[model samples]
Target: MLELVVHPRVSARHPQLSDEDVRVAWQNSFFQALRTGSKNSPEYLWIGIDGKGREIEMVGVPTATGYLIYHANTPLSKRVRDEVKGRRT
Candidate 1:
């Protein structure tokens, strides 16, 4: 059997983005802007990741946390679950 792995990597330019730029990118990609907060003086934004690690499709930057993700191309959650199950020996 062949194992498949998929990971989404944000380009270096993403972190370099100004808050506004990040917002724009977020809006364009996810159709919403994320809220910003700080913990321990470090600013962090909450972005939702599905089981496959891909941001939810077409859902706006969630005003709150706990977004439920579903299939876009393939069911990533199942794949991730399979990977996890495989690792448990």
Candidate 2:
């Protein structure tokens, strides 16, 4: 099984991120990124939702099995989160 790994830096934003949160976000981001990936295509910045509907942003690199996670509390993540928060989804 592919172990869902979390980087320590993710704590730079939301200190409340549990292992379970990153795991679920990783799984959701990984599969969704794969579905959108293609040969010769550029990388994608993915926006996915967690079980409770909090938005998660991750970078999808070519040939990568995992994503670079940004818990909604980080500077960059928080900015994106705030920007999208007001929009109807």
Q: Count clashing pairs, candidate 2.
A: 2
When summed lDDT is taken over every stretch of 10 residues in candidate 1, the lowest stretch is 2-11
lDDT of 1 by residue, 1-89 (tens): 22211112222323332333323333344222222332322221223333334542211222133331111221224543454355455
Models 1 onward score TM values of 0.20, 0.44
* lDDT by candidate, in order shown: 0.29, 0.50
Q: lDDT by residue for model 2 over 35-89, one digit each (tens)?
A: 2444524544456556655656654344356444433331235645564454435
Task: Give the lDDT of residue 63 in candidate 2.
Answer: 35
Which stretch of 10 consecutive residues in model 2 shows the poorest summed lDDT? Answer: 67-76
Q: What number of clashing residue pairs does each candidate have, in the order they appear?
A: 0, 2
Where does model 1 exceed 4 Å of error?
1-15, 30-89
* Positional deviation of residue 37's Cα in model 1 after best superposition, in angstroms: 23
- Candidate 1 lDDT for residue 62: 21
